[model samples]
Target: MYILKKNEKFNIDNETITFREIRDKLTEEFTELVKAIVNYSYDKTLKNLKAVVREAFDVIQVCILILRKCHTISKDLDYPD
Candidate 1:
């Protein structure tokens, strides 16, 4: 799916993609990919999966930190309370 700008046109096999449509499609695709990865890791030996889980946890931690910082900054700018 492609995002169209003003006066932009494109042909697709199905239908023209909108911003929301693209967003939803991407969300579903990412969700499916994560699910597949997790399932594969689960079916593997613990020794092999440990590193992958640890890396995933680290990524989660970093994402949480970044999100917290973003929230703090957004709140500070929007409402200094």
Candidate 2:
């Protein structure tokens, strides 16, 4: 998203976005995804499908943002997989 494309321009509460903010956002998005999944499991309606898709995308987008922001620290870590 725009944050990944222009992270320098993004701000939250008049402050730069931080890992804590990202973590909080990720947690909230994931919780919404779980709620959507649970609702879909019982309803199985088109509306529920759309909700699930939307929530999933939200979770994925936040994850992508995290990955994009983590590039700076990736060099300091080791990956065997």
Candidate 3:
């Protein structure tokens, strides 16, 4: 993500994915979404706010998907937390 530094790392304890891996995915997708917004802004002479909005939505959607998956696993394990 843009929030992450280029050399910073985090351990996510996932069975298959590291934190860097997930962050990379989020960054790539968000970059694509931002590029789309920027393209539209440039082509239409719109504002930079479009890029901010699209990036926010992309992050939120990615978070929701990850949270939901974890929540489901938690429920299956009967863990409230």
Total clashes, candidate 1? Answer: 0
Write the residue-wise lDDT of candidate 2 on 1-81 in tens digits: 444444442333312457889898889889999999999999999999999999888888778777766774676679622
Between the candidate structures 2 and 3, which one is better when assessed by lDDT?
Answer: 2
The residue pairs that clash in candidate 2, if any, are none
Candidate 3: where is the Cα deviation over 4 Å? 1-24, 30-46
Q: How many clashes in each candidate? A: 0, 0, 0
Which pairs in model 3 have colliding backbones? none
lDDT of the candidates, in the order given: 0.46, 0.74, 0.59
Q: Give the per-residue lDDT of model 1 (tens digit) for 1-81.
A: 122232122121122334454445445545645765686667876654665565555444334434444555567585645
Badly placed stretches (over 4 Å) of model 1 are 1-44, 79-81
Top candidate when judged by TM-score against the true structure: 2
TM-score (all chains, Cα) for each model:
0.40, 0.71, 0.46
